[model samples]
Target: MKAAVVGLGVEGIKATKALLDYGWKVYATDLQTEIDLEELKISISDAKISTYDEKINISTNNLTIDLGYLDECEIDSSDAIVISPSLCNTKIAKKALSSGKLLSDILDKHKEIFTIGITGTNGKTTTSLILKEILENAGKKILIGGNAGGGFEGYYDLILKAEKGNYDIIIIEVCDMTLEFCDYAFNFDLVGLTNIGNDHIDVHGSIENYKNSLLNFSKNKTTFIDKNQIYLKEFKESNQINELVEYDESNYDLKLFGKFNRLNAGLATAIAKVLDVEDFIIKNTLGNFEPVEGRLKEFKLNDSKIYIGKTDNSDAVKSILNEKYFYATFIGTPRSNEEHRFEILDTVASHNPEIIVLFPGLEDTVEFGLYRLKSIGYEGRIEIANNLDEIISLLAEYSHEDAIFIGGNGQKNIIEIQDRLELLTKNCN
Candidate 1:
């Protein structure tokens, strides 16, 4: 079976590896130069992908990613096309759908199966992973993937393995990117809409476009709404939805912590009920399942100081509402016309915490927040750590005084930093 995997982003890289593992003649091409090819080649080789095409003898052992202008690549003859991270582009989505190619829009193919789709701005990843753990613990063979964020790279192989008539429930985190190319022909047994927030405006251009894309994803499925507390509710009509089920804490004992997680648990439980997972198993899994690393993940220091990685979205910082002393961090600022930087800064200031450390890596991103902070005449000790080690060391040294280190800005190595902090603290104690 000949297959073509599009784009070379993280998702595309993973999908290409999956296609090869499925015993397919894989044609993986990206629009990158020779220099950009090294990292991707290394990743594919590390994954040990094997291509079946005699013409394209690319094996994981011989990791050489071939590059071509998109116009030149031979995609027409491939038996199936997998549109992944790259499908975010409307032009590519339009081209693939119009081509009449048998396209697996996402890595986890949900054709003729009990599939659950989750979408929203922020909590999708946490909710998707939580739901997957709940279903799996219930002894339901589950295949979970789709831009839900928890490194579900090789889900296609899992689906293929399950095709031997094994798994019952399949959970997929369907992002706007995945939904853009998704043939709405497929419907989910449960559709989870966590919450609508302003995000990815650079790609969609407007709030209306972003909200519509999400609403379109939940259309006609067993839609799960945590709450109707979304600004975009004005754009949607209540009567438009067919079988909308609103889930809240009164329904199930969801184990995940935080108000945001509580909301996610509500959605997960609703889907579990649809799949008929036992209440006992659902409760057990929720209690056992820990938050994924680097996402509000906690780390302790020898001095008894605590650091929490709150990096994904600004709204994620809201999870730390009750905590008194929070040293919040942030990353890439929103595009010029896209996002508002003051909203987060204003919220952080409103708390009137002991200290605010702003370490925005991309100088420009930090400037917006810094400017906003200065405008308020806030005289808290605001310091910037240039590198990851500096940030960790700073947190270790100065943050010993009963303060919560909220690591976010330019902390891409958040998981590693959190792990090291925990390990160091353990040894010191």
Candidate 2:
């Protein structure tokens, strides 16, 4: 069988490899041919897979539109087109649905198979990882990948490969953008929609749009919902799904402290229950599951505390609970809702935090947070560091007793920060 993997993102590249591994002739395309396929560990010498520029204009014989808004080729004869996470493009989804091709949107495919699709603005990664741990502990042969769900590349092929093994359950982390790409929904045995927050408007456009996208993603599945303020009682009335479980926030018996995480743990527990996983196993796994990297990861300096989380949008900072005697750092860009950023600043200021460090990211997105902080009557101490290392150094110098938070999309930089922290920890020892 021949498969076309679209978009050169991590998901696309992984999908291409899975196709090639399964002995399928794979054609990969990306608008930017310079995309670092090597980072995804794709070997150029592999004969089964070929990467080409989006403008290459292939023959109409066997083509698939992998890149959104760049679908100039024809996919009339391809056996199937596997659209992975990039399914965010409405046009690509429409084309796939209309073309009648053997379409497998990872989100949709997850729904079709005995899969668990987890989606939300945040906490999906941690929730998916926790659920994976729970299922694996139960001795169920499982395949986990997609979004924060890493490892296997192509979803369908992974499912096929698992047939040779003894795995029964598959867990996936689905992003909102890819929600529309689902064609032939594999309605998950269990689904989880983590807390909905004001995020990803650049893609989803509006909060309602984002919620609707999520609703679509969980089509006809036994879904578990985190009690989101925005989506509260959202699932209670939905007749589309008969097995929806409204997870209680208080049922989260995990070591993860944040309210958001409590919701995540609760949702995971609800899903685990659906799978007949024992309560003790669920509770133990929840307590054992530490926050995922770059999301509330705790790093202790000599006399300071630093917490890091992915902060592509400013709304992430709202998750930080107000506490006394701790200075908080607002890292990364701000979002469309300046109120959220200002609210965070006011919260920090009200706490009279020892310090407020801002890492306005390298893009326009940073403005929403930094400016909001300044406008919110916070004149005490605000310093913008060049990078994570400088920020860490500065934190070490100022108020040694205060807590530090490295927030935002800047988290991809944590690997370097971890290296530096290790060096510092070693030097002290």
TM-score for each candidate, following the candidate numbering: 0.80, 0.79
Query: 402-427 in candidate 2: lDDT tens per residue?
Result: 56766654455554565576577567
Which window of ten consecutive residues has the lowest lDDT sum in model 1? 49-58
Which candidate leads the pack in lDDT?
Answer: 2
Please list the Cα RMSD from the true structure of every candidate, rounded to 1 decimal place: 5.3, 4.9
Predict model 1's lDDT versus the native. 0.60
Steric clash count of candidate 1? 2
Per-residue lDDT tens digits for candidate 1, residues 1-429, read 677766666666665666556665666666553323342445543654343322222345423344544432557766666556445455765677677663444333456678777777767777888888887787777776765134555334434544445567667766655675443534477778887664555677776787777666656655777655564354346455557777775244543446677778777888788778898888877777787766666555644456465444445555555544555433333323434434556566666765676654324456666677789877776665555676667666654565564644333456666777777777766
How far in Å is the alpha carbon of 127 misplaced in model 2?
Answer: 1.0
lDDT of 1 at 294: 61
Candidate 2 versus the native: TM-score? Answer: 0.79
Candidate 2, residue 152: how far the Cα is off, in Å:
7.9
